[model samples]
Target: MYGPLPARDPVFSRPLQPRVHPAGAGGRLRQFRHDAFDRGMSPLLVVDHVQSAGPEMEPLPHAGLSVATLLFEHAQGEIESVDSAGARHCIRPGDLHWTLAGRGVVRQARARGESLSLDALQILVNSPSDLKQQPPASFHLAAAKVPLIALPGSRLRLLAGQLGAVRSPLVLPQPLLILDGRVDAGATVALPLPAGWNAWVYALSGELALEADGAGTRALPATTAVTAGAHLADVQLRIRGVGTRSHLVVVAGAAINEPLVQHGPFVMNTRQEVMRVVQDYEAGRLGRL
Candidate 1:
C-alpha cells in the first residue's frame, strides 16, 4: 500500500568517497560506501568500478543477491563468464550481465583477446526477504538492446528501469533505475527521480556539479559518489559538466528498510540465513560451472 510522494523539490546529501583497492592482475577497483545514508542506499549493498588488464576472475558464490555488471565505453576485449548452470555469456563494450542469486550460484569471468583490458561497473543489490529462498537465474543484455537518450550535449544509456520514454530491456526482481552517460563540458542534463526513491550519482571521470530543486549545487569530483532523495516528493536532479567532459552513472531504487545481514557475497535477513547459504555453497548444492 505504498504510494508516490507529493510533488516537491529534491534533497541532496554530501558526497561519499571511495576506497581504492587492487583487483585482478594489474587491475584497480574503487568501492563506495555510505553508512550514514543507509536508508537511501537500501537494496544497494555494493558499487564497484573495476579496471582490469586481461586477468581471469576466480569463481565466486552468491545468494540472496542480484548482481549486475555493465561494461563501459573504454572497455577493450571480451569478458566471458560461466555460471553454475553451465550458462556462458560473452560481454562486450556497453553490454550488461545480470544475475539473481536467489538461493545460490557460482560464477566466474575472464578477459578474452590480445589487448586484454576491461572497464566496468559491478553493482550488487540485495534481494527482498521474501525472495531470498527462491531459485537462481541470470540473463544478458546486449548493448544493442539498451535504449539511448541522445541530447544536444549528452548521451545516456538506460541500463535498467525506465527513464522518460526510454526503458531498458533487462528485468530484475525489484524496480531499479540505472543510467550511464557522459555530459559535455558547459552542458547540463536534468534527470527525474520518482517520489520516495533514493538515488546515488557517481562521477566516473572529470568534474561535475549536482543541484537539486531547493538545495545548493554540490561538486562531484572524479571517483566520488553523492546521494539524493526526498521521502515525500518527486525531485529533479540537474547535473552539469564542470571544467571538462564528465562520465557518470546514476542508480536509484526505493528503500526496502529490511534488516540486511551480509557475509561476502551472501546477503540475507539474518546471520543464521547467511550461514545456511554458506553451507549450501560449500556442499556444492549451489552447483559448479
Candidate 2:
C-alpha cells in the first residue's frame, strides 16, 4: 500500500468585487477589483482585464508601482517599450511583460499592426518600502518559452513563481505565483496553495466550481474574480468544470501588513511618500522615455 497522502485544505470561493471600466490609449480596459491592504490582499492591488487591447499609445511616466502584463492573443502587431533604466524591448503575442516602477520610470506601448487584435491581463502590485527606490527593472517572457504542464483533461502553465517542482523564468519584486489553466468539461483539478497566502481565482471563460473543506462551493463565471485567504493549513483548491470548457488564472502571494497608499499610478506606504512620487514625476525625476 502507498504511504499517507499530504494534508490538504480546501479553497473557499467568493464573488468578484465591483468591476471598473477605464478608458485610455489602451482602449477601454476592464478592471476586476482592487484588494485592500488591511482586510484583503495587500501586495496584489489590481487585476485588469481578462482581455484588453488598445491603439498606439504615447509614452507615459509612472512611479511607486509594479505591473505585469499577460498577452495571450495578438495579431501582427508588436509592443515596444522603454523604461527609465534605459531598458527597451519589443513584445509579441503569448508573452509576459513585467515593469517595476521602483523609484520612477517612463514607458510607452503602441500597436504596430494595421488592425491588431490584442488581448492581455494587466496586474498591478505594491512594492515594500525598502525596495521602492531601487532602479526600475523590466522583463519580457516569451510565450513559447513558458513551461507547460499537461494533465488528463487540463493543461497548466506557469506564468510566474514556482509550481509543483517547476519554476518560472520571469522574476517579480514579490514572491507571487500565477497560473493559467484550461480544463475540459467534467474535469476536476486540485490546486495546492501555501498556508497563510492570499489567493485569487479569475474565470476567463465558461463556468466552474471552487470549494474548500469547511467552505461551501461557489460558482465562477467569465470575466469574474474571487479572493480567498485565511488558510491555517495548506489548502488544496478543488476546481471542477461546470460548462463545456473552463479557463482560469490563479494568483497568490503572502500578505504584506505594511501601510498602503495609492494615487493614480503611484502606490506607496504613506501619503507623504505618495506626494513625493508625484513631485518626483513632475520634476522629471523618472527620466524621459
Candidate 3:
C-alpha cells in the first residue's frame, strides 16, 4: 500500500450515468438501473456526500456480493429494513451493517428517521462467481469497536480493509479498505494502501486537492473518484481537509476480468446468464416476487 502521497486535483474525465434504483414507488422510492456494462475491470464508484433522501431501501434481491454501509451521525440517525425473509432490523447512528449476499438472497435496504445532515457511505464488494451460492450473513460492528488510526494531525476511522499498520473490520473476498479521516484545515494525512491491491479515496464533505502519480493533479468534487487502479500496488492517496469523518470509501479489487452482465441488482458474467436469471426470477426460481 502507498501512503502520504499528495492527492491529485480531480477532473471528471468521463461522464457518469445515473445510478440504478429498482422500479416501482410510494412511501419511498429507489433508482432503477439499466444494464450498463462498459469500462471493463473497473468496479469502483465513489458516491460522495449524498444526503439521505430519507433513505428507504426495501427488500431487493442481491446475488454474489457483499455490502458495507456506514452512518456517521454527529447527533443521531437510524436505518430500518426487513430482510428478504421478512426479518426486522435497524442500525442506529455511529453503527454499521455488513451484508454478505451469497447465492440467491432476497435483501432490502431503507433509511428511516432523521437528524440534520446525517452523512454516511455504502460500499459493495463483488463475490466471486463460483461462490455466489454461499449463504448470506450480516455483521453489525459497534462504532466504539472500530479501530481508529491516528496520524500526526488527523484521526481516521478504520472501517474495513487494512492500512499499512492498521487492520480492517472483516476478512473480505477482495482487498478493499474504508477509512474516515478528518484533518483540521491545514492538517495532512498520508493515505497508505496495501500491497497487491489498488486504492481510491473520495471526498464527501470538504473539497480535496489531490496529487497522483500518472493521473496528475486535480480537485475532487463531492461524489468523485480520487484514485482508481486495477491492482492494489498501483494506487496512492493523500488529503488535506477540515472536517469530521471526511467520509470516504477506500476500495481495491482485482478486475472481474470477464464480461460483467448486470441487469439491475444481479451482476452475472454473461448476457445469456443474466437473461436466464431474469427468466428464473419471473418463473419463481429465486422465490417470492
Candidate with the greatest TM-score versus the true structure:
1
Candidate 3 lDDT, tens digit per residue, 44-137? 4223233444545565776666666677756255766455544456766676677766655666666665353445556555666775656666
The full ranking of all candidates by lDDT, starting with the best, is: 1, 2, 3
lDDT string for model 1 (158-225, tens) is 88899878888888778989889999888898888777778889999998899877787889999888
lDDT tens string, model 2, 1-289? 9999744324553466436565544455667545431236546788876333466567777677787777764334566766767888777777888898888788876656565666667787777787687889997888888899887788888888887788998887778888888988888877777777887788888888888777768788776677777557877778888877888888888767788788878877889988998898888887886
Candidates 1 and 3, the one with greater TM-score: 1
| Clashing residue pairs found in predicted model 1 | none
Cα deviation of 200 in candidate 2 (Å)?
1.6
| lDDT, residue 235, candidate 2 | 73
In order, the Cα lDDT scores of the candidates are 0.84, 0.74, 0.55
Q: Kindly give the number of clashing pairs for every candidate.
A: 0, 2, 35
Candidate 2 residue 64 Cα shift, in angstroms, is 2.5
- Candidate 3: count of backbone clashes, pairs at least 3 residues apart or interchain: 35
Query: Candidates ranked by TM-score, best first?
Result: 1, 2, 3
- Evaluate model 3: give its TM-score: 0.73
lDDT of 3 at 262: 67
TM-score of 1: 0.91
